[model samples]
Target chain A: MEERQRVRRPGGRAARVGAAVHQAVTDLISERGYGKFTVGDVAARAGVADSSVYRRWGNLEALLTDVALTRLNARSPMPDTGSLAGDLHTYAANVAREITGPEGLALLRLAVALSGNGQQGRRALDDLLAERARHLQSMLDRAGERGERAPDALEVLDHVMAPMYIRVLFGLDPLTPEYVDGLVDRLL
Target chain B: MEERQRVRRPGGRAARVGAAVHQAVTDLISERGYGKFTVGDVAARAGVADSSVYRRWGNLEALLTDVALTRLNARSPMPDTGSLAGDLHTYAANVAREITGPEGLALLRLAVALSGNGQQGRRALDDLLAERARHLQSMLDRAGERGERAPDALEVLDHVMAPMYIRVLFGLDPLTPEYVDGLVDRLL
Candidate 1:
């Protein structure tokens, strides 16, 4: 079995500083956007020294990426249901709630804007997406192993999850619980 | 019956000028990025007056948005193979090809980056997404009408299409035609 790597959660002074800096960065991005916000603004907003912000995150892109990841991790985990359909419904609802939330939408908008610029920005966006995909894949894998789903379950799982992001990211429509349930029924 | 929208094909001096300006903007965004590129730079690159560029597009955001939309429309239309499986395979393959292609990847990277910023930028990103979704939805809707798909065909379509975009946009993994086939088989 491949061992899952553990990520370090912020702790001690680093945690406190990270929390403050992240909150500041989020506020700045929401207020002025990535185009207008700067490391100096983040430092001023957080009431920390400029060097302190730079020492921790290295650059504006790195700082915002970290903040986005930290906020994501703080959210509730995907629920475990005996059935794949039940689990998917719960998962989709959770995702819909998060994506539609104020902070989530703001951060998402920022990531989308920054994703096309530089190598660092691209990697940051890719990393966040990979993390989420892995989580969804793991859940589907477990369902398959339990004989609750077919051997090639990722395809079905992807079909279910993809539309939610499409609806939200594309602004074509809203992702509602009804939509999620409809997807779960057809897919699983 | 709803009237079908005709695809605009650029011709004549004014149309050619617009195309040239759009190409320049795309090149600039790919090379220098949206954040760094300006209307003046685009006009200079296209060999057009700055006022001309502004007159054509109200602002830089509007210009880039229109350019992105035009490029997307110019791509070959999705094939109609009369079979959902075959059509999906073609569609997914096309998406994978574009997402992995040099220009496609560049544009995708740009779209992702800009997704999170100012209202104008966010709306632009949304419009690009809606065009693609509408394309997919139309295909799926046709299948449903023909009694060749499930009652909830859109959900089925979403399941198949979403993963490919998720993989490409998020850089989770490369999408293969085989995977697309598998998705179609399972979903259908």
Candidate 2:
């Protein structure tokens, strides 16, 4: 029936299942924190069979990685506002919202927890980071083509993203719009 | 008996027990990660009585907080090298080593794990950050008193400390001397 659903509706049922499972994962991370819940818990929460989750994601770590990547990437979307400053402002503001949003801390904590577990977890962390880096590099490259002096990808990570993540993780002050913009100004 | 030993040797027996317990906590965090072990586990690993652990720390969270604050503060002494440039270089280099050290990752992971747990965890996290901010502020104050320009304590944190910490948490690149020094240089 599950295979038939995938075949019949393609994006319709499969995407719904995927979204349900991802939401379940995020909710679990928020309530139970990392390493406390399991695939069965997620399956039960999502109202999907355990076998379906395993068949689709293979394991909890993969499901978590998928959730983080899909949600974070979908939330931020790369900005190309025709100027480097505008691009950075939009990009940094998007990140601030994503990290401070209802599901943001859960995903960030999931990434941190996954990174230290073992080989599989390490791979998941690497994939999430690589994807973000690639996304940001494309933006930087566009700036270069437009003859705008853009900082390196790592610089953006260090100056902008790193501060915001650290603040969120440590439960510090809010990532105000001015504060986020200040980071961009300093980098430029 | 513990009281007698404290009276007889002053800091001798008390200090030894504290060190042993803290080492055990670090080792357990390294091996088993956070929230898996308890006061009993720490006591057994340290070769001290559970009562002793409880008496000193009051509970597991308190013990963990003490370990984090004591070790982190000791490892990264605020450098006052008579120049802001010299002070920042030394300070950043010291932090680079502390986070990348053997026991460093465990303590850091513990902090991240604890911050999301509950009220006690939040307090522990706040204590750690406050101590760090206090230490850094002293260094910046010294620089200012010496008739040198100094960035805000938060700026050093945003620029120098945040990047190193985020990198460590995500298992990113090594904090090479050039990279650490560059953070200070840019801040200046």
TM-scores of all candidate predictions against the true structure: 0.77, 0.89
Q: Could you give candidate 1's per-residue lDDT for residues B59-106 as a string of tens digits? A: 887787777777766663777888766777787677667767557765
- Consecutive 10-residue window with the lowest summed lDDT within model 1 chain B: B1-10
Alpha carbon lDDT at A48, candidate 2: 91
TM-score of 1: 0.77
lDDT for position B7 in model 1: 39
In candidate 1, which residue ranges exceed 4 Å CA deviation?
A1-16, A31-36, A81-86, A110-119, A122-153, B1-13, B76-88, B109-153
Q: What value does the lDDT take at residue A139 in candidate 2? A: 95
* DockQ for all candidate structures vs. native: 0.33, 0.69
Model 2 over residues B13-117: C-alpha lDDT tens digits?
A: 888898899999999888777766889999999999999998888998888878887887778888878888998999999889988965898878878887887
Candidate 2's C-alpha runs over 4 A off are A1-15, A49-55, B1-17, B36-44, B48-59
